[model samples]
Target: MSQSLLIFAKILSPITSYLNPNTKPPTIAKRYKGKATLKLDIPQGVADLLLKGVINTDTRTYECIVEIIGDEDGSQSDTAKLVVLVAPSTPVCKIAGVAEYGQNINLTCLSEEGTPSPAYKWQSHDVNNVPRPNPPKTTDKNGILSLYNISKDTSGFYICTSTNEIRSAKCFIILAVMQPPMNKVSTCVILAAVAAVIIFGIIIFFYCCRKKNKPEEYEMGRSDEAGGKQLFCCHGIISSSRCAVTPTNNV
Candidate 1:
């Protein structure tokens, strides 16, 4: 009689769990660790989620088993999907005005659209070019960035990152400060005053020109030789000689 050799194989179902409470749960990959051997005792739904690209791991307790499926040759396959979670979605910042030395600055971050709440952090290009003081500002609860009364030393590029095991987003904020001797508000006022003075001078010049062009007037009076007789007109209509003889004494 010849001896017989046999191989034993076990088939297991997939892992299906709710990754997010509000959104549809993601599907896990079918093969984990590039293995084709299926485990026994996998649930029907869980087996499907595993094939879709999800890794089963109890984040809170880490009790879930990781299953890997391989091909006929037993070579590892690339069908499993694992997601890393980081928070705050679409983080960005804007400058209210020119960031100047010793000026109070405001920086805000928003992450309302992310699956999981994101977080904020401030960074600068250090002398050695290293990212230091990671997580300059963060909240353990929610994602909201608020920086009030900022100073010149705080001027630099900031990064806002959002991740939740499935998807991620990033944004950068550049802070620049300018300290000039001239104040912006005072410069505007000075320019306005100079303009007003120039306008007033122009108005006075036009008014004087109008006054000089006015017509002059002269009053007509009787000549002394006519003895109260009317003065002679240029056309001789009222000549002194044409007066009545009552002025004969003058003649």
Candidate 2:
């Protein structure tokens, strides 16, 4: 009596085998016998088919059949499916439309490669550093977050998380709502006015200090027939006169 085995890759490509009765040695298909990764256990009726060193792209179903030669019954067969899971990669996030106040915007998040296509969740941190779900916005199944009538209060740090059955990943971006150009100009003008006031105050302080340190002056009176003179010293407009001694003894 003799027996044979057949293994199919996805039920399409077949690998045939022959079992010799007297030698107890099984012969495998020539095409698959030389493969280093392929292994066969004839006695146990097991075959390990190695697709390749890398399994990223080799996920599919496989089937196998075992039969006894000259038997009235048909061959026994089984099938199995293969699945490869990959963790979610770093997600990419983008904001569509202007981020100004009172405008609509869309935040898109995507993870290009993952096993069991990844789903997304959005989180945000406000100016107060509190974490919560993004408000005034709606997220869809495709991972798009829509913000309607945005405002300064809506600006903060946003995080996009991508997750699947395998694993999860996240990416973040900062949302800054800017004031109008005219408002910025107004702020600049206000700052400039404040600086001018400070400079004027410094100038007035120095002027007052110089005036306080000025030297006092005295006024000299005309000489009289007696050949004596009087001096008037003015201290901030309050003056007093002091008379000089008459010179008559020398004469």
Candidate 3:
């Protein structure tokens, strides 16, 4: 009849462990004649083998093996799969083109590093920090928001939220749709028009004054006894007042 002995081994070290020949050997004597003994000062439970931390470049799994030399059961081993959890980071946002009326633009959000790839959600708000009644037309996909032929109504604050199973993060940007400048009447043109009108008025006023101050001429009829003579005078009418000078002519 063969005797069977059960040996229990507890791995109590940092990340990795291995047997050292110079300090201690892991093999048992073939004939069971030699005494094989292991002293464990600090008892550590198996649950402590499962390592957990934030996911980064140095995350990996570790394995522990328990071996018995004379046991009917061969070598027995167990592996601990270490998994690191990472929360979502603040999303980076970018605008593709100028925010102007009648122009097409795109807003993009990105969460570069996360344990689980993050999803994106887009929202808009007005200048007063209130949600708009009717949001602009957009295509929400992956992490991009597209606006076609944007208008003044599309100008506002855009919020981009990135979410994962672990956590969520958000970022915001302002979309300002610029309006084309209005055409204004020039001051130079107005002043030129006013000056032209004044010059025309002055010309008309001088013409009227010249016509009013010019001298007047009159022709007077002579009596029959004066042998049918005609008279011309200046500065007075023939019948009203005496003339300063008179010119007589025969009919």
Candidate 4:
């Protein structure tokens, strides 16, 4: 019987190599040391790749190679695919675009981790917690639910489910469509409040800066001896109402 050597490859990189030297069983690469092994008995006519604790990274193409020693035959190889399935992870729900009357928006859901790719489904419920039907002319496909010409009546809670062969996961969000005017008012209010905060912060920053870098006090008003009205300036911290008028009198 002609002796033979076998090699296992993950995209041409050998994980384990069995040589005809007959000195040892098989040499497994350090990276795959404890994770992979070969069946010693080749009499079974098939080389079996035994693996343990397989993970998602193990999903890839695998090739088994055989070479007959000292023969005209060079080497023969067979290829196969290994796919590790993972259950869907918790999905994230999101809303895109403004939620307001007569507006269009999209509700999105996604699972970060899943094998074979997870499919998505959306369910709607009224504010009263009662199940409701998808809006007419609505498009729900590929993890996105599109709502066109939405109104206050379109406000509700939406649930999205991500499913795969391994398992399923779910996430939800509440949509409260408001009137256009109310939405604009709310936005303006938020902007105004933010602007006020920023302005206040700037004033405080300049005040503290000047407090730390106070310059020498020099004459800033006209002398009474010059017959000009001596305008005394009320110097205060930045933003202090007392400093509303800056003295422009000639010194």
Candidate 5:
């Protein structure tokens, strides 16, 4: 008994397609060459479509039909689904909005390819690359990390990870949060003026001390709360498939 086979690629979306069954090996369609082939065992009454190196695009519903050569009305058909799972690819990192003090900014990370639409995570580090906590009102959703009223403390590095059940990939960017230009310029000028005055005073003191044959040195140091750049802690959101850092007393 000889067998004839018919195949169609269709799924929930209903794409009309047909695969030729009139060749010695049961020819696959042109677009399916190399990607698809047929396996037939006449004696065993079996015919199957073999797919190779399937990708995300290959995920769909397929239908197969089998007919006995002499029995025009005797045909069997079956439908099946193919689902492809892919790991997240390396994400592209970006910064939206200005990273200026007291201004809103968003850090966005995107994975160009993934099967299940990867989730995202954002982590912050200090200038020293040491892990740091996010500010009071940081919000991360879908791949957008929103920081409100960024300050100098927000100046550092940020890493974004894209993840799925299959695997994960990551990308990073530097965030140098700055004061507004006008404010920054004014601050610089003021600091310079203060330094000059301090220097002039030191010169006068050294001159007077030199005349008296006495030597003394002055040292200046500065410390700020944000300058400490300590790592922050987090209250993780488990249900949302987000990655969160643990909180520490240092926060």
Candidate 6:
């Protein structure tokens, strides 16, 4: 039994060593071209293998495959294709809000993401049944739609269509016409005119009453100033000279 165990131990030690040889670590091979460059890293132990011809870095303008070697029979390999895209992304269009009548309404369409700069087209329709004949006019360099001097006729549905070479999107806003506040202003003017007329009539009536009572008031004042009140007498003076006076108890 001791001899059998010794033989088994010796056989397992060689098998383990044979299975675990000096293995090369995995690596990444990259190829770059133009203004853009591709970078790759191989582990320290396997980096020497990449420096050798084991890893192919020789393709037109930097293309290669990483070949991994180990104690195993077959060497595994991987291909790395590196593409550099420097173009910008496409922008998105959105309708922020709409403006009402008699207001400076602003409609905004913005790109959430993009590079080559998206373009904007603004179209509007009115209730008059006629389509907006003209093409959408660009409002800003940054794609902002400013509807200035809004009026009743200016109220309508506005559409902002944004497009890029790859994709396109549209957004819209419905602008309502706000009726000018007529009742308040008209009622105020009317009330003011009515009050003015009422005030004028009151003043004129008092002035006329005062004028009508002026003669009677003046006569009463003069009579009060005279101090001597007299009664009406129809007889004239009977005797100018001194008259004899008679006092009699029986006559």
Using TM-score as the measure, the top candidate is 4
* Residues 17-134 of candidate 2: C-alpha lDDT, one tens digit per residue: 4443435434445655543244576677676666544354545677766676677595787888877777888999999988987788888899988877888988889977689676
- After aligning candidate 3 to the native by TM-score, how far in Å is the CA of 150 from where it should be? 0.8
Name the candidate, 5 or 6, with the larger TM-score value: 5
User: Tens digit of lDDT per residue, candidate 3, span 1-251?
Assistant: 23222233333423333232224433433422132233332224232232223345434554555444466485666656544556778989999987877888899999877666788998889877788543556788998998889888888899999998898999988888986444323666778899999999999999888867866544564554555645544344444333554455669
Backbone clashes, each candidate: 31, 0, 0, 0, 2, 3
Off by over 4 Å in 4: 181-251
Q: Clashing residue pairs in candidate 5, if any?
A: 133-232, 233-247
Q: Residue 126 lDDT in model 4? A: 92
Question: Please, what are the lDDT tens digits per residue for candidate 5 over residues 151-243?
Answer: 898889999999999999999999998767897789999999999999999999998777566343223333336756333322311232223
Residue-pair clash count for candidate 2: 0
Q: TM-scores of all models?
A: 0.31, 0.57, 0.48, 0.70, 0.60, 0.38
Q: Which residue pairs of candidate 6 clash?
A: 88-115, 89-114, 89-115
User: In candidate 3, where is summed lDDT lowest over 10 consecutive residues?
Assistant: 42-51
Using lDDT, rank the candidates from best to worst: 4, 5, 2, 3, 6, 1
lDDT of 4 by residue, 25-104 (tens): 78899998888988866776667898899888899999998998886567799999998999989999999999988899
As a TM-score, model 4 comes out at: 0.70
On lDDT, the stronger of 2 and 3 is 2
Q: What's the CA RMSD of model 3 in angstroms?
A: 17.3
Model 6 C-alpha lDDT per residue in residues 1-251, reported as the tens digit of each score: 01100000111121011111224322222321121222223233221112222122232132222323332434333333322222223334444444444455567776664334567777778866356742233254356776665667776677777666656667766667676578967999999999999999999999888777653221111122354543221222332233343454666
lDDT-better candidate, 4 vs 5: 4
Error of 1 at 11 (Å): 38
RMSD of each: 16.8, 15.1, 17.3, 15.4, 27.0, 20.5
- TM-score, structure 1 vs. true: 0.31
